[model samples]
Target: MRRLFTGLAAGFLLLGTAACGSSDGSGASDAGAASGGTTTLKVGVIPILDVAPVYLGQKQGFYAKRGLKLQLIPAQGGAAIVPGVVSGQFQFGFSNTTSLLVAQSKKLPVKAVANGVASTAEDGADFAGITVKKGSPLTSPKQLAGKKVAVNTLNNICDTSIRESVRKDGGDASKVEFVEMPFDQMPAALAGGQVDAACTPEPALATVKAAGGKSIASNFFDVSPDLTVAMYFTSQQYAQKNPELVKRFQEATIESLKYADSHPDEVREILTTYTKIPDTLLGRLTLPRWPAEPDRASIERLARLAQQDGLFKQSPDLDKLLP
Candidate 1:
């Protein structure tokens, strides 16, 4: 479950000025010299397992070695972070592909910079699942019709996947009511009879199961197979103005992703430093597939799915959206 931060206006204002001042009018770089001549880049991210590589990069000095100082700012969801990136408050942001595509369709000047997370088919490694209370009468996605389902955000990955899952199961996807709730609060909400089911992502999925929630369906199984679930993005201006900085950021991120892929224990240990998830539960949390580079095909597949789900008026211009 993700914890959302409250105040960002003040931070946005302060950072926006800094970011604009750093640009030299040539679209050559987003990094600017601070007190010690180090370039500081503020990044907006949700505090989840998907962002583990970002934390790992910081902890291991992968970005610092490239003369980039990363300011990892946490937000509740993409709704908050996308605006920060668009307004120059954050030089870059991490969000799901669905949110970014929606933003791009609406003409938000953002381009994906790096891969964030992906899904896998390995047993016990389902990163997201639709869960119901233990021994609930709802045994399958079909039963979810006319029932209230909780998701971290509306019209994003969780909601879209669950809707598709229901449709694939011969359920009336349109009848399934989707309620917006934070992943962290979903378990309690489910247990309290507030929501019939929850489309939850790990480690919230793990936490909910520990609290007696049972999985009805794996969200990724039907809607998105080996999907590129999330990605790191920056404004179009930032990418064009600072290609070198973006390249360096991508390099550091890929290195961290590879490191995290090979070292699960270390990744979990680093995750504790950013997320409030307890150390004991970290071992049980399902980890996402951390790709070394963003896959255009997977992203295009997601865009098509989002379009088919009515999330967009028209297909997003992948040529311009992908970086």
Candidate 2:
């Protein structure tokens, strides 16, 4: 996968701090004292449309103005970043709500610091879907029974939602097979008939559709209306020990989200710098709903789904999991 660290590195330097830490034992907090005692935060992120706000916030100096320096480390998926956040290798991280809930169920010390991406209201843009190649016999979710489906990660949002969608459409979700594959690769996978269908989010959704793949279902809405797809989080110890830092980070993130919400063109432009999605495809991508604050109801719903899906032995304590 192509990484987009160049622009992020320059953004950190412009904020008067090195993107990565120096050798003086000042790792995440390596900001110079002259920069108003700035704290450098190593953030774990996936290079997808959902994380555009973080990049936009950096480009607009939102975090820097709040005495924070963000170094974005790209991971293949949310599950891969959980260990880093727990180990303090990443001071902050982004992951889907289901992944965090599962981690919290196992008593991981992670707590959400801010909201990331969400689903739109009914009939709004489809940010996530199950795509099948055009002219395929499958036209509805019910037809997916006994068929193979592709998801970025197993036992995460994609897996959970796809099953829920198929079941809701009267299909035997248990009979369906799920294959793990990266979102960016789903388009090719679908075209090559590697999987019967691909569960993907934008711009992969757009990419698959552009390549003659038709969406059989909107996974986000099918799972729940106005679903909170992902969130930003930190270890519970880190948030409690540095409450001020957490507050500043949240404020900066919210500001950036608002900017991305209001300026789609600019957000897409910024995404082009960090993601491998081509400039022409940027205009065709469906942007996820980047809400400024985490929604309690949405999160609670996810926990309930996790319990139903048997991902958690019991529903996680939403009060402790959320910020």
Candidate 3:
């Protein structure tokens, strides 16, 4: 299996903080001074709009008002982001619930304190789906047996969702081959016929759809209804050391979400500044909802799935990982 971080450093350069919502450690707000002279927050994020609240907060001066200086690191995927938080490279990182739950189940020591986003079948909700070439005979998950499928990573949300989706359709997941393809490369890979199917999130999903590919299965809500698909997670040590900062960060992020909800076009403009994806693609992308309250049940289901997949042999105590 190819390590997910292989292309991350270069990928970061391509999509690194241009229209960034990240702070540069400068003290610019009264709320920030109350927390500390400069409450520096290093964050890991993917390019998708689920973290729009954080970006909105940064743009709207919420973080500044709280006196927090945020340094945003655009992570390659959930697998790479989890290690960054566990090792203290980032005070907090955005990740899919599956990856964080798996790490926590295996004793990596992390906690998810805020709600992220959920992928419903709504018009703008970005979820994972199996995409095949337009003319391919494979139109259903059951037809994927013994074929190659690409995911951002194996043993993570993309893979877990794909597998569960196949099982639901009476297909043997073990009989199929899983490949690792980054979001940027998936389109070309599919166009070149490198893989029969690809599992991805938007705007990559939109990219595939635009490339004349068809979706066979979409499992964002089906696999786990009201699931906390992705969220902001941190080490317990950070929370213990900076409870006030964490609270302020959450407040700023929530405020940002509200702003983005009211100003979708402006948020898309902000996204183009930070991501390699163009504004037109951003317009077609499906974004997740930013909730204020963290959902405990969705997180618990993540732990259970991780154990079932052998990502962990035993369940880690949930109390140690909650705020």
Q: Which stretches of candidate 3 lie over 4 Å from their true place?
A: 1-36, 121-126
Q: Identify the superior model by lDDT, candidate 1 or candidate 2.
A: 2
Error of 3 at 155 (Å): 1.8
lDDT of 1 by residue, 1-323 (tens): 02211223443455557566443322225445323355778788887788888888888899889877788898767756776786776788898888888878867677887888888765335878899987689988988999999987667777777877888889988789988877788888999999999977877788888877788888776655677888888888777777778888888888888988888888889877877787778878888789877677767777877788788777788788776
lDDT for 199 in candidate 3 is: 82
Candidate 1: pairs in clash: 27-241, 28-241, 29-241
Give residue 180's error in model 3 in angstroms.
1.8
The alpha-carbon lDDT assigned to residue 94 of candidate 1 equals 91
Ranking by TM-score: 2, 1, 3
The collision pairs in model 2 are none
lDDT of 2 by residue, 1-323 (tens): 01112422333344223323331213443244335677778899987889999999998999999888898998777776666676666789999988888878878778898999988755336777889987788998888888999988767888788877888888888788988877888888889999999888888888887877788888878767878899999878667666777788889999998999999999889977877787778888887778878777877877887778778786688889887
Model 2 segments more than 4 A misplaced: 1-35
**Of the candidates shown, which would achieve the greatest lDDT relative to the real structure?**
2
Q: Report the alpha-carbon TM-score of model 2 versus the true structure.
A: 0.88
TM-score (all chains, Cα) for each model: 0.88, 0.88, 0.84
Output the worst ten-in-a-row residue range by lDDT, candidate 3. 19-28
Candidate 3 Cα deviation (angstroms), residue 285: 1.9
